[model samples]
Target: MTGSPLLALPGAVVGEGLDAGVAAHYGNPMVEQRRLEQGRAFVDLSHRGVLTVTGPDRLTWLNSMASQALDRLAPGEGAEALFLDASGHVEHAVHFVDDGGRTWLVVERDEAAPLAAWLDRMRFMLRVEVADVTAEVAVVGVMADPSALPAPHAADAIVWHDPWSAASPRGYQYARDPQHPASAWNWTELVVPRAWLSELADAVRSGRAEVAGVLALEALRIAAWRPRFATEVDDKTLPHELDWLRSAVDLHKGCYRGQETVAKVMNLGRPPRRLVMLHLDGSDTVLPVAGDPVVGEKVRPEPAPGEATERRVVGRITSAAMHHELGPIALAVVKRAVPATIELIVESHGIDVAAAQVEIVPADAGAAVEVPRLPRLGVRP
Candidate 1:
């Protein structure tokens, strides 16, 4: 399939569309990063997929299927939803925005075909139309002042403004720090016609605009402790584990796929595992990959068989990046019971790297950690 024309630029390091898609860096990642942080750069995320759902039943119908309440969504509003299997395992993470007439869905490129097929199969008798419009439209991510971008393609271009508003009304944050990176997170994506890439590319070529690669974006995302479907999810993954409940799942929303498991896990107990940010030591010069084992100093009273070593692999790195502000950082999935005080190690390929645990999902990650008291039968405050 053809992709964003900008990917052909010199020094553009292209990789799989999911992880590093367009460019790793346009020669200097640092300069590109500044431009992005200052709202002067954008990323060509057209490599991702775009699917649209039309017809009158779009909102109500979608509400019945995803983990978010979409029925009340007004025009130009956006929300993140998860499609899960019967057992509540997240199958797809959808970032969508609606313009009254059509609801646009953004997801990993590889996920488009399958997800579209499933949606089609589910639309038995509903007045819904699902179409993959990826080829006709492109997605460009920008961190610069979004207002500066041209208006959306009259009924064609749709800008999905991220509501990284520290916290949303329908969400709850497990990380209570006021200075969390997400509190300042800034990014937005613009959907344009496929042919618009050349003009945008020319702007970067003529020094009118700056182009930052996915690597820079990934670094910012990691620093912000944001989770992505491509890097952080697995078959057994639950939203709570990644503190995603703060942004994705609506606690009191109506039913949808995986609602039961989500409610049960959040209310009655903690997720079996949790997501944590790792401040990796760069001394070893080895960066952990998605599957790199994260071992912790064994504090088990009795080491399990084959676990006699002082440290045992307890988790794996989900995403890693070298940030502009923070040196080397990574997000890892680890057992919920793991102590936050433990020394985590990522030893792989003859590199022994030490990591400091910065809890994204606190060890006590549960929804009902505090119970509210019922007011006296007839008494008032």
Candidate 2:
């Protein structure tokens, strides 16, 4: 991994491994979060990756390949797309923006190379040109600034403005919030040159620019109930379960790789699982992290003397955070059969915390197919 540019800023703490992976914070997440919510700071997203596609057939070709209808994507327009296997399992979550001359894709850091390679293989006779541009560009997150950085690539820093602030175009929202946290979500990622990082951080220190860290961004993102490809997706993940129809998957788009499964599940079957926001009980002072087992109160066999019944694992936490206002919160994936009123427990290192489920997708979603009535003895011959 290359050194991140935000390290030039004072008090920068780079979180290595799965949890932090990038600049966790410049000391205090609360202060940084305040700065971000107030549009006074930016987050360093250089650890992520970027890919660009250019060609006359880019839009139409992409339209036929992904989950969204991209053929009509106008310049400066942005939309989310998902790459799925033929079985409909989510393979990749894509953030895309078209700037007329080029279509930029923002993906998880480790996925850029593989995604570009896949695109190349699918370009047999199309005019599409695919390139992994991670080495040439960096991603910077901001609450409001859209100014391009002073670098060749940054000259037209393609900004993929987040559409989570409101209900997406023709998308379905399962959760209703009168004052949604995303309502103030002005998150935007700026694609800049790798060399411009230090200058941007310096601008933050000299009071010329404002900056935050990934921790603050994560906290706010989790609070908004947004799903991220890095932490939220697994090999068995399905878009409908996450309520991703709010942005990623369009129900009326032309056929794509996994359209069969997507359409089938949307019209005839219910996803095996559903997404929920967990309002965790913080009395234990223990917060669960991603992959923590979400155990429910299911029937268990009798225990021996001085023993406790074994509770079956019903779900797993995908993301968790301590929000400035919402306190400790998390997002979890649970079985579709799990009842809405059930309370879950997160067992972490022998500590247990109570979790209340807030529905993102109703467990019974898409299970409305009618069954035929059997003929009775008194029926007409």
Clashes of each: 2, 1
- Which stretch of 10 consecutive residues in model 2 shows the poorest summed lDDT? 147-156
In model 1, the runs with Cα more than 4 Å from the true position are 148-156, 299-309, 367-381
Error of 1 at 350 (Å): 2.4
State, as a TM-score between 0 and 1, how close model 2 is to the true structure. Answer: 0.91
**Residue 201, model 1, lDDT:** 80
Local lDDT at 338 for model 1: 89
Report the lDDT tens digits of candidate 2 across residue range 1-381: 567767857888887655345688889998888888777777888878799999999999888889988888999889889999998989988889999999999998888889998999999899989998888888887777564233343356778888777777666665554665667777888877776777886676777776777878888888877889888889999888887878788877757999898878876788889888999999887878889999987644765687765587889999888888888889999999988888899987689999998887776676435656689998897
> What digit string (tens of lDDT, one per residue) describes model 1 on residues 1-381?
565678778788775536455667777776777778778778878788899999999999988988877888899888888888888888998988998899999998889999999999999899999999988888888874454344343245687766654676776677766788886677788778888888778776877666888888888888889898888999999888888777777877857888898888877778889889999998777788888999987557877887656767789999998877788899999998888888899876768899999988888666665668799898988
Candidate 2 backbone collisions, by pair: 15-21
The segments of candidate 2 whose C-alpha lies over 4 angstroms from its true place after superposition are 18-21, 145-156, 176-181, 299-310, 368-381
